[model samples]
Target: MPTVRVTRYVTPLREGGSLPGVVEAEDLGTYVCKFRGAGQGPRVLVAEVIVAGLARLLEIPTPDQVVLDVDPEIARYEADEEVQDLLNASAGLNLGIDFLPGAFGYDPISEPARDLAGRVLWLDALTANVDRSWRNPNLLVWRGVLYAIDHGASLYFHHSWPGGTGDPVRFAAQPYDASEHILRGYAAEARDQDVVLGKRLDDDALRSVLAEVCDDWLEPVPGAEDADALRERYVAFLRARLDGDRGWLPGEGAA
Candidate 1:
């Protein structure tokens, strides 16, 4: 991923608790930057990058990610005190996704193609993402293409890491309840895609994906001696879940 210096702080996204802002970078491109200082913390950004990597392997159309280097001096020019505070606090590397101008929020009034829906559902299930319900789909329609975003809420086990890296096997055994998934109608498609999807993320591919994350982004854990150890724990968790039995996998629903 490319790193860009923030040239301007545009606006706060009024919705999410993380207060991700629209910012202009030195590359003359606009991006939605997730602040490192957000209450949910850097772990969410780690999840975002890793999941985006997985989506890339699956051919999912997600926004290109970049690391935004924020400058504290820019905060003084901000009018909104809240956004100013966020900028002041996030004066270093933050998460940025290419801003899709005029993208509309996804509403599940109709179904998308089965294969695409299946790939999406499978990705969510594999990551244990619980956020993509109808109310907050976290999906966008840009230039008539569907794009996935905001994966910070996935990988629930990592929140326990301040104490220790939790058991990967327990996460592997955890069952996904897709009854309320935005793409629940295409559960069968997710299952069909699952046969080949897990194989796509072999050890090497997983390492490359984890490498996208910078060492500093990983929060320190009790037993984790360094960033490589922290990354290994994530890889171990993914391997366990991917190779585990399909018992937790969702069943078919109406097409």
Candidate 2:
């Protein structure tokens, strides 16, 4: 990911639990910055990087991500106590998604293409993402294009890790519920996409995607030992899910 120094904190986006912010960077670009020190911690950033890479590989539209270098001094000038506190704690590298000006939240009125929706559903199911329901689509519509965002809620298995990674086979066996998914109706189509997209996630492709994750974000876990080990765990988990039974695919005996 490209690195950029945050020059200004534009405003706080309080719609979500973590309270990500819109800010300006050294490259004269605006971004929605996800703080590493947020309540969910760097693990959420790890999900963001990994999923974003997967999205790109599957031809999903998403904003460009950057490694935002935040200065501690910016916190001192923040007027809001809550915002200031967050800035103070996030005085280092944070995750930044290039902000799209005038983007509107996605609604059912303007549905995306069937193939696009299927690919999205496939990606979410593959990652065991539990956050793309109708209640919180986590999608943005900019210039009539649908863009996926806020994947911090996916890959729930990582949250259970005390010092090591979770069981890949267990995650692979877990069934995904598409009843409330934004693209729930496209489950059948997604299954077709599953066959095609699944084949694309070979070792080299997964490695390229995993390479985008920052080492700092891969916090050391007990059995994992270090960031590289942790990354390998993630790769293994994903590969297991891909190569394991396709029962997790929506409409394929999935809930």
C-alpha local distance difference test of each model: 0.89, 0.89
Candidate 1 error regions (>4 Å): 253-255
- Model 1 collision count: 0
For residues 1-255, write the lDDT of model 2, one tens digit per residue. 899999999999999999899999999999999999897899999999999999998999999999999997998888899999899888889999999999999997776898998888899988988898889999899998999998888888899887567679998888888888888888877987787898888988988888888888888777797887888888888999999988788994333
Q: On a 0 to 100 scale, what is the lDDT of residue 42 in model 2?
A: 94
- Deviation in Å, model 1, residue 17 alpha carbon: 1.2
lDDT of 2 at 253: 39
Q: How far is candidate 2 from the true structure (C-alpha RMSD, Å)?
A: 1.4
Encode model 1's per-residue lDDT on 1-255: one tens digit a residue: 889999988888978888898999999999999989887888999999999999999988899999999999999998888888888888899999999999999878855667988898889988999999888899999998889999998888889999999789999999988888888787887888787988899999999999999787997798786899999999999999988996667876423
**Candidate 2 clashing pairs, residues 3+ apart or interchain:** 163-221, 163-222
Using alpha carbons, what is the TM-score of model 2?
Answer: 0.97
Error of 1 at 215 (Å): 1.3
TM-score of each: 0.97, 0.97
Clashing residue pairs found in predicted model 1:
none
